[model samples]
Target: MKKIMLIATLLSILVEGYAQEKCDTVFVRASTENGIIEGFEKAGVRIFRGIPYAQPPVGELRWREPQPVKNWGGVKKTVQFGPRAMQLPVFSDMRFRSNGMSEDCLYLNVWTPSKNYREKLPVLVYFYGGGFIAGDGSEYRYDGESMARQGIIAVTINYRLGIFGFFSHPELTRESPHRASGNYGLLDQAAALQWVKRNIARFGGDPGKITIGGESAGSFSVSAQMASPLSRHLIAGAIGESGSLLGFREMLSLAEAENRGLLFQKAVGAGNLNDLRTLPADRLLKMTQRKDVPSFGVIVDGYFFPEKPETIFSKGKQAHVPLLVGWNSMEGHYKALLGNEEVTVENYEKAVRQRYPDIAEGLLKVYKANSDEEVAQVATDLAGDMFIGYGTWNWSDIHAQTGDKKVYRYYFVHPRPGYKNAKTGDDPLIKGAVHSAEIEYVLGNLPVNDVYDWQSEDYFVSTLSQLFFAHFIKKGNPNGFGVPVWLPVRPNQPADVMIIGSNTRLQKEQHRDRYLYLRNVHF
Candidate 1:
């Protein structure tokens, strides 16, 4: 009887402990339109990583718009980051925490502040930039935790890349219900937006207050979304950094895109769509390295865009949402514009004249050099304009003109600290905000990347910058009582912009004439 009593008591204690633990620890769960998902909690934020927003585009689905993800019967655990889109390590700066690389990379990560699934917060959906060739949402620099802490729901997403994402051919176009090919990457973005609309409310985000943002190719994508009829209605606001389609390259027509795809087929010795589809992902990715593989850029597929983006903007048919857009201080390096020649006044003038023969005098006047010493400064401006400046500035110009909604412009001028190691690449950096330098600051992620020695000024900049972003996200305007006063681009007056740096302040657009001249000159 004593032994039986002791054994029964032990069993009772064990059962009580298990029941107590089960009651004490509450797991976070949220239901989507498709199914229920389980996410982890960290530092007061509920994180759902690697949630499938669409089906993996493999085999027959290659080069097609993302398909809907299949619903699961049980709660899906979203723990690990999905594989990065198929890509080569083209950039040295890229560092990822994802599982690896694969064609099955259509995933998105969400960071939300609400512990319960009932609080509807504003949503910020960010896209990673890689010239549309490479980039992943799992990059440490773009982590959404910081933004989530600021009372907003932040999400980062992955889309297809390189040949698998953008390839176009006659056979592929013929099979499409829309009679279009290419731009599957952009279509993936639209599809993701649709998914968010259907499911974000379940994740504690308001469907109406969504802002789409990105840098470089991602920035160009925001502009593309604004022009795309399928996506424009989904966009409530926009944020573009460093690039847009309107500046330099024009969109390729569907037929032109298909012709390039045909060339790709001939170069790869593939006869038809079936032959290309049967090729392994590795084989298709390897072809991207060859010179004969025609480069695929954003094209005017009739489904994505009714016409060219430029034409859409000109006619004021693009999305009439409030826009916060700008580029960095140095989008292009001096060497790119100077070529083999030194930064001499004579060389600078010659280069300008050669490039803009018809508008040399106007170009020279806008990009004026006071002395030989000032050549670098003038050249930097000229070079940046040539690369991403003209396009970005042109975008703000058109939006401010026709959108009627407030447009806030900015110039990211703060450069990163000089590297501690002379061997590191960012040490010999120019005295301007290098391309993508503002990312860490904007996302409040200075601590994650130890590439450079961060200073107090960096933190100060980040605090202000993120506040501006958060403010804009919470409310359409980026200004409030506590935040620095940010004014919109004044109509008919000189275009004004907030200089986001150590000393954050509002200022009028500098060298507006130069951008204007380049706009016409490029035309």
Candidate 2:
């Protein structure tokens, strides 16, 4: 009788423990304008993935502006990521955790630290960069969990890509209620912003405190958004890692975009927009891969962009939000300038003269190379400037001059350590921080990226960089306790750029002459 009672008591204790554990499990939920969504809580952060912000752009909706998401009846399971946007594998660095690839890809993911909507934390909406042709919100480097941990509501959104997002036709323009075609990808982003403004408060985000940020083409989108009348009022601040729409590439007029669309239609043997819409998504994507197909890109539609982005910024008509913008140390390489030739001074001069014959003398003077060793570094600088550095600098200069907001510029120079599991001689020497290298560091996601053998300094840099960004997102200024004092760019003054590396410090801008010279010369 005694043994039986003891065993029964032990079983009762076990059952009670299991029940208590079950009761402790928290299921986080939030109510949006559409409906209530249940998100999973992990390590105190509530994550909602693959929430549709707009209707799927499919069938007749192909090549059209994204439609509003309709209200659903039941509690939709937003646990898994939605399908990524339609894109070919153009970049090797891109890694997606999305459910799959499809045309129905207008979804977004959110990570919030607040337990209730009353917290009203600041929000960071980041757009991925794949030259505006490739990229997904589900990329590991773009994960918002870490940023959320820092008392932010971090969001990543997917917009259309390549032909699916940028194709424009006269038919499309005629059909549009706004009489605008092309820039559907940008339009998708704007729609997502609208959705967030209306619904983010439910997720514990302050709609009035939203900061838009991105890198490369994503950075271009930020500039475009600031200049667009539709999205400028919706953002409190802007962060651009590199590149801008102002000068990275020329924005096409509607006529040019329509002509390109016509060429694409002819190339695919589609007689009209109706036939183009009827084709399968896979076939349409494959057709875009052909060598003769004119690459679809952003257009200056009168709706999204009333005037050129440069003109808007010049006229101080863009969103005068606090701006944080910079580029990496090496956005391009000497190989881009030398091609197959060795990095020799003579070859460098010849290449410069060949590429810029009209301004060769002035260019060589600005990007001077005296010796072979000097040629490699000088050529690298010139190549980087020609590719993106000059444009980024031009953006900062123009914004500082015309806008009333403060501009904080940075120069990321911390190169990644090396691969952890590399063999004796397999690791290549990284010259400098390359383009898109600062994403993980600035997002506090160095640990999420397992490819690099991250060092203590890397973690230090990551923490420091994220702190700067977090402070910027929170208060529109990156200066805070425990971080280096970063000065802002003053109008018509020598701008001080924060050189971020093992020894992060402020340095006066040294390449203004180079950019000024490039600014005058047409390429």
Candidate 3:
């Protein structure tokens, strides 16, 4: 009898423990402006995935501004990621955790450390980079849980891509009350910002303390957002990495965008706007893959952009928020300059002369290479400057000269470690940090990406980098305890940039001559 009683007591205790565990891990619910959403909590952080910020942009609503999500009754489950934007597999590095591709991809994910609405935390909204053609918020490199762990509310949102997002026609302009066309993707971002301002408080995020950040094209979007009146008031700070809209690329005029749209309609045999609207999204997407099809790009619509981004920044009419921006060491490879030629000084000189015949001597003087071995690094610097570095520098310089807020600059130089279990010659030797390499480190998502054989040094760099980002998001300054001092860029002074690497420290700008020369030649 005693043995049976003991066995029964053990069974009861196990059952009670299991029940308690289940209760502790119950799904969390938050009320949004549209409706209540149910999301699961893990490791003390609440995660809400695929929460619709806008109505499905399908059928007639295609190529239009994002519409407000209609209110729904009952609790809606948002545990799974929504579909990614419509795009081709243009980049190999992107790995998605989304449902699928679709035009109805205006959703966002949120990660918060707050237990209740009263615990209002600073928020960071990150935009993914794919040159405005391909990217998704569901990419693992952009997971927000790590930032959430640092007492922040992190958000990742999806905007339309390629033709689905940027298609512009005369009819579109006629229909728009703002008398604009194109830039629908940017408009989607603005809509998402408005959504956050209206609803983030319910998720325990302070609506007034939101920071926007991105890399590459997303970084360009940051500059565009700052310049535009729509989203300027919505952001408290901005973080741009490796690119900007200032002078990197020319924004197409609405008339040029409409001409491209007309060409597309002719290519697709669409009779009119109605026919284009009825065309299947997959068919439209496949047509974009044609070589002759002009790439859909951002436009200087009178709505999202009243004028050129450069004009806005020059006039000091952009957002006056604290700006933290930088670029990588090797944004472009030497091969871009040398093409198929061998890495020789003669070949490097010939390539520079061919590209900039009138000013090759001045460029050669600025980007000097004495020996054959030195040609690769020198060519890489020049190529990187022409590619994106010069534009990023121009943005920082212009903002410092115009804006009232503090500007912090950096040059990320930490090369990612090699892959695990890789054969010899499988991975090319990386000389410096390539473009987009800083995303994982700055977001504290190194562990989320398992492809790299991360070392203790990588983790240390990630920790330090994320600390700077978190501090900036919280207080509009990257400086904090336990990190090296980062000075803000002063107008008309020699800029001090934080060199982020194994031995991260502040360094004087050594290549201003290169950037200035490129600016004079290109602009």
* Model 3, runs deviating above 4 Å: 1-25, 423-430
165-201 per-residue lDDT for model 2 (tens digits): 9989999999999999999999999999999999999
Task: Note the Cα lDDT for every prediction shown.
Answer: 0.87, 0.90, 0.91
Flag clash pairs in model 3. Answer: none
TM-scores vs. true structure, each candidate: 0.92, 0.94, 0.94
Q: Report the lDDT tens digits of candidate 3 across residue range 1-523.
A: 9999999999999999999987887699999988999999989899999999999999989988889999999999998899999999989999999999998899999999989777879999998999999999999999999999999999999999889889899999999888888898999999998999888999999999999999998999899899999999999999999999876577899999999999888887889999999988999899998887787888898899999998899899999999999999999888888888988999999999998899999999999999998888898888888788988998899999998999999999998877778842421423888899999999999999998899999999998999999999999999998789999999977899999999999999987888888778766
Candidate 1 segments exceeding 4 Å error: 1-27, 354-361, 420-430
Q: What local lDDT does model 1 show for residue 510?
A: 68
Best by lDDT: 3
RMSD of 2: 5.3
Q: List the candidate numbers ranked by TM-score, top first.
A: 3, 2, 1
What total of clashing residue pairs does each candidate reach? 1, 0, 0
Candidate 1 on 94-194: residue-level lDDT in tens?
99999899999999999998877688899999999998889999998899999999999999999988787888899988999889889988988898888
lDDT of 3 at 40: 91
